[model samples]
Target: MKRRLALTAIALAVGAAASLSACSPGTASGTELVVTTFGGEWQKNFTDAVVKPFEKENNVTVKQVTLYSSDALAQLQAQKSSPQMDVVFFSGGQETVAAKDGLLAPIDPAALTNAPDLISQATAGLAGGRGPVVQITPMGLLYRTDKVSEPTSWNDPFNPDYRQHVAFTDLSNSYGTLGMLMINQARGGTIDNVTPGIDAIGQSTRAGDAIITKTSSDLQQAFAARDIWMAPYSQDYAETLRKAGQPVGFAIPKEGTTGSFITANLVAGRSNTELATKFIDYALSAGAQEKFVTGMAYSPVNTKAVVPADMQSKILAGPTLEKLVRFDPEQITGNAAAWQKQWQEQITR
Candidate 1:
């Protein structure tokens, strides 16, 4: 439900190749690649599944800085004239906003060997955007299989009997907001207009039927403890839990679930362009994709990579995949302030 942040710090000895490359003409000596990301299980998964392998393969040390996307964006904005971070990973929408604000450098897809194999939608979603934000994972819902019947629609969460048992994340979360938007759309509401869903959530909150949490870990813990019957959750979390033998399942409703792509951006005027490119390539590699799916249960954006068998039958099924609803990031970015205000007033209070 709530967007959780996960941070992983990996330290590896720099390979001679990397060291020599760093010492080259324009590169800084012994520079730490500060990669930013949300903190929690995903961070651990990333380190175990991706970072460790990359560090070993490249023989380079990486220092990770973890913070909420908004905070990172603010820091980047404040230091625009002299950027502090070398690489950043944030929500697709935030990436677009940062790109528009001139905080990111354009990525050269051709530089990545796996770039051509990436899903067309994934590339198209991030291409032509000023920022480095690209969709990293598709969004969906996570629920306790023991407590829920097979859900055919998003409206199932609104069942009167399940009232107070339904936990949801804060509305300010792009993913959570999109979940709400999906519910609205299923009920015949517009994406640009969330008033109907806001009113619905307001009524639920008033009746003490809706539980709002501030973090994804909190929501996951609540669900794991059976404190709530269902909540909109990240595909990554649901997969991780289920793999751990928890009785959880994930789905995208018939009305369609809202999804976003995540992208990494280079800080303006940074001298580590080559290193950044290598990092990106490593992150999107087939081996990395396999580890991501096997360890995190997320679908890889790389088309050539095979999805794990367990997940292929669960969250990666066709029906669930087809229900993913893509939104116009430009419009959402333009109206973010207004949306936040409405969410605070109607859902958070």
Candidate 2:
């Protein structure tokens, strides 16, 4: 049964009284779990789809802390000696670094009943003992349909006709970097080399043909206010804009796109390991995955999760799904600092 606000308040009062009792020092701890999640609409949908159901089924209260992937990792490192969060959600492969630093617990595939239903891509992190990819958002081109014709390739942002109306996501954002890499690869640039992409975007910026946005909100505002007609962003965000009544569309440029995987990991050294793992398993289940697809337009990593026919055209599937380019996480992680520095010195400057 769903806990109503009044019941939750009364339970909190009762719990507080119980905590003060000498015999119940850890009573609440046993029934409470902390998990880190994203903010805004992401958190709302996640709570409705996964958290609430888990809380109801497990008869536990899930305390959700809003933190982006990188910030959440930093918090984990800070709390390593006395970990507070039980489970962590990561969308940018920060789990790779978290696992390396021993901040994340190794997930046992056998423990996850939904493990068998996951697609191969979702299991990519399994061999390395990282968390499973619960969901994915395809990084693609975001443009105003009413402002410009559909973009057929990654190179369309460079068209002179769209001068001063293109937006490039700064290197700090994962999707931004992925977008840059896609263009680079399309023009024959390797992961080891980002100069072609950097130079291309720099030229556009220097010529006043494009603008650089440091965050997703900046991109949204730019498009909303009609300052930018096009940008390389993820599909879910394109939906965000459309829902806001903006005339926008997402396109998978011919060069293909990359999948932004959102993973749920068990935090190391937490007493709630079993419950935390159960939550992770629940998130990977088809029902939870389908809820995310319907609520947030995210592509499911579970093959059994069905997308409605009308929604199928807006998400990654079929040929578009086939076009997913899996980049080396190591390449992105190892070179991120250098790329950021270069972006500042060569592009942002």
Candidate 3:
């Protein structure tokens, strides 16, 4: 969920317009459930793996509104008085803030049949009264294998030879935020004091050694056109670039990496809490998890999901999964605003 104000406004407009369609009577004459999701390929993968199956089993029509996590949060706040959305997807710990703001409803583990199958990492949110973590995307260094040598460390982006060829994601993106935090931590800066990371990256940007990108699409375009040789991005997206025929390689730097735990939460005030919980449970099921793994290359949070050895190498699993550097979601949620402000003023500006 990386974005700036303008893109957010456009997303809100789209949400407002799409909300009208969400209220329409179902032609199938069944229950209707509205959910928030990413657009394009992501929406297609989710529909194939989760939405369509859930719809068939439950006899419900699930309407998906395409919005990044930030805009989705904004739309939830706007509709807080009466939430039109039943299920919402979040990747950047936005669920933490949304839950605290009462925009999300609590989950009952007993209501979710797949609760017992979830990995311990996915169950953390249940105790905090938020939704269970449905999927995970690890952050890592992405490089064009042909254009640059493999990056074994996060500091590789700062190498003088790669100047002007390094793409830095703005903090508005969730992965961007995590990448910056990882670099900041690797450089001896705490979450409360990210100046070291900011200053170091900023020095490169100021010297015209790096290009600041606003969205995942931007990264793809840059890599596709050879505008950038390397960047810090999520592993799932790295696969996207590879499948698109870009010569891409992803690495979990020696300093370690973090991950985006995409969560599916029941929106507060939705009349279809039971149905929404059912959908959430289906998303966490081994069946659906397997589909997501094959369709989207996302790491499954269900311990029972069977990923082949070859496919496992493509995702954040096994030894690579164990290398994840855990950060406090509560701290990240609390400091996100100030960090964003600092990012704009000190880095992007």
lDDT of the candidates, in the order given: 0.68, 0.86, 0.84
RMSD of each: 10.6, 7.2, 10.9
Global fold similarity of model 3 (TM-score): 0.87
Tell me the TM-score of each prediction against the true structure: 0.84, 0.90, 0.87
lDDT per residue (tens digit) for residues 1-349 in model 1: 1222222111123465566766554334343466776677667877876677777777777777887777888888887887767778777466677877888877776777777776655555346544332235565666778878767677777889787788777766766777777777776778678777767766787678888776766776777674787777677767667666678777766656666556667766678767776777777777777777777666676666677665685545323443456677777767678877887787656
Off by over 4 Å in 2: 1-28, 318-323
Total clashes for model 1: 14
* lDDT (10s digit) by residue, model 3, range 1-349: 5568889999999999787655643211229888889898889999999999988888889989898888998998897887778889988778888898898889988898988877777877877768888888888899989989788988899999998899989987888889999889888998889998888888889899998888988999888774799999988898898889998888888888899888899888766788888889999999999888888888888878899777876787534554566687789878888888887777746
Query: Which residue pairs in candidate 2 have backbone atoms (N, alpha carbon, C) closer than 3 angstroms, thus clashing?
Result: none
> Is candidate 1 or 3 superior in lDDT?
3
Which structure among the candidates has the greatest TM-score? 2
Tell me the lDDT of model 3 at 324.
Answer: 66
RMSD of 1: 10.6
> Which model scores highest in lDDT?
2
Model 2, position 218: C-alpha lDDT score: 89
* Of 2 and 3, the candidate ranking higher by lDDT: 2
By lDDT, the better pick of 1 and 2 is 2
